[model samples]
Target: MAFFTKEQAKAAARRSENMLDQVAGLESYSDERFDVFLSHSMLDQDLVVGVAMLLKEQGYSVYIDWVEDEELDREHVDKETAERLRQRMRNCSSLIYIATDRSGQSKWMPWELGYFDGYKDGGVAILPLVDTVNSGFDGQEYLGLYPLVNQVNQRLYVEDASKVHSDFWAFVNDPSR
Candidate 1:
């Protein structure tokens, strides 16, 4: 097998960098403690995993579905689990939504958005990462579909995943200003 050409290697490196950029606090903020809620479609697992890892490194509690096996079966999603996630979303100082694909009719993403919608006034911040340009022929598009938060709408998008992490952190760190 031939090694990747220089251009191929550079492309790979750029992709890696883009993955890291999807979330903001990957550098280990051992001193700052914050709760982060991650909402996204399963189609965007790549970006979600990156954000989760970065937030975990930053000493932030991250509530990510599917990662850590927190995802509940559609039929088994009891009230308790819903409440737990809801509470996390409502109380988390920072809410990061990896909206890389359409969550229009997703299993739980819309609900997560609803939770954030209710607590927008509590200073709960909302950050979105649009990692993908399109989610294959699902016949659904997610470029501009934003989760509507109460009076305040806070969402950001990036075609590159590497940059999303830093932007997310910046939003979480300075949500008010």
Candidate 2:
């Protein structure tokens, strides 16, 4: 019943510094089934990588653009990049929006959320990483429409406050969910 916070994410980053040993790059969209297409700000590269590793430890295949597609050039905005992301999103069962102070600045996060929301019919959750559990994602827009992802003993869960809270694993495992 604990919220996922920035401190925990940072710890994960420290827990394992290198991802090359963990996830194999060049993950084929057609060959792989990803549990979450991590929608995040490229500015927070380390944080996102940590989150991906954390999720992988929980037995989920995560699709991170730069990780999977190393050829992806974030600096160069192109229609193909969007299309590639679209294809990855299609292969994922859910999308986790890594909400932080830098999250609002990402051009792809909103589009990823919107596309996944429409494509998966609301298969998106915001993993709001704040400085403290008591703090929240303030001034961020359009994030409340979906559930929130949190951690408990390193396990992931999704919950819509005042509604329902369930395991992140269960959500991905359940087809009707």
Candidate 3:
């Protein structure tokens, strides 16, 4: 549950804002099946919901498993449920793994990430939502070679809400970076 220093958060926010400005023109090109599939631990529902809402507000199609379907029993995911989850992953252009403390321990998050990587041939962007407002993240190494949205040195992670819009759109439009 360690948090970023105020100064570090501010710097990250500024970087986010700059990135947004640079990628402002990319909105027109980002028309994918699903803009993002938000993968997170069930324990961090509220935070993930907020992030999904923000993305949706920016006109990005976000797929959050529990929110999109009421039939999913979080406590008991059966074979059918697993297949449905894989289907959703296939439909997404990007996967945003909410890299929080709880997510690190979740059995499904890593599996989903692996599935996406294999299905998309590493073409789809796999971004980590680090430095979240509520939860702390394990070190960047925990992401295990995946590109991250909120790493300390990376240009994508931003604390400012408005900046996130630009950063995300930019990432989706050009996942190769």
Candidate 4:
């Protein structure tokens, strides 16, 4: 997995901020059942939950596999489970893939991303949540091929949770992304 420099990350963040300002009041256009479908490795459950909580606090409705049903084993994807995942992907306005080291080897994260990509083309915002350790994003060559959230650092920039929330909503609501 490769990473992006701080300069590149800042540039992306600036672009996203500018775009958010341009489309500040377009939330009404987003009518998806859920604001975001947070895709992550089951191993990163703690981090995923933290991110979900932060988004929920900002008044964003987030959908995660664990929140749906504990008994639903994702390891073995039955026909019903597959359908359920598909439905959830369709309902969400965007998909934010928690791109941690664990997620790099996840069986479900890539599948979920591919599913969402096929479902909406460029309509749904597909973003990646990189680690904040070094403020550098690894696996950019792979994840960068698709649309991603713009943040100051490699992380979600949750230090200012509102900015993350607003940027995500703006990205998803904007059809021109």
- For lDDT, the strongest prediction is 2
The TM-score of candidate 3 is: 0.63
Q: Which runs of model 1 end up more than 4 angstroms from their true locations?
A: 1-34, 56-60, 68-71, 122-170, 173-177
Candidates 3 and 4 compared: the better one by TM-score is: 4
lDDT of each residue in 34-111, candidate 4, tens digit only: 778888888866566655655564567777766654456766879888777888778777787766667777887888
Residue 132, candidate 3: alpha-carbon lDDT? 45
By TM-score, how accurate is candidate 2? 0.90
lDDT of 2 by residue, 1-177 (tens): 466777777788888777755565654656577888899998898788778878877788888887788877878879998888888888899988898889988887888889888988758888877888767555365787888887666677788857587878877766863
Which digits, one per residue and each the tens of the lDDT, describe model 1 over residues 1-62? 01112232233334545434443434322233346667767765555555555455445566
- Report the C-alpha lDDT of model 3 over 31-112, residue by residue, as the tens digit: 3267788888888765565555445545777777765555578788899888888887777877877665567678898888
TM-score of each: 0.49, 0.90, 0.63, 0.66
lDDT of 3 at 95: 83
Model number with the top TM-score: 2
Count of residue pairs whose backbone atoms collide, per candidate: 17, 0, 0, 0
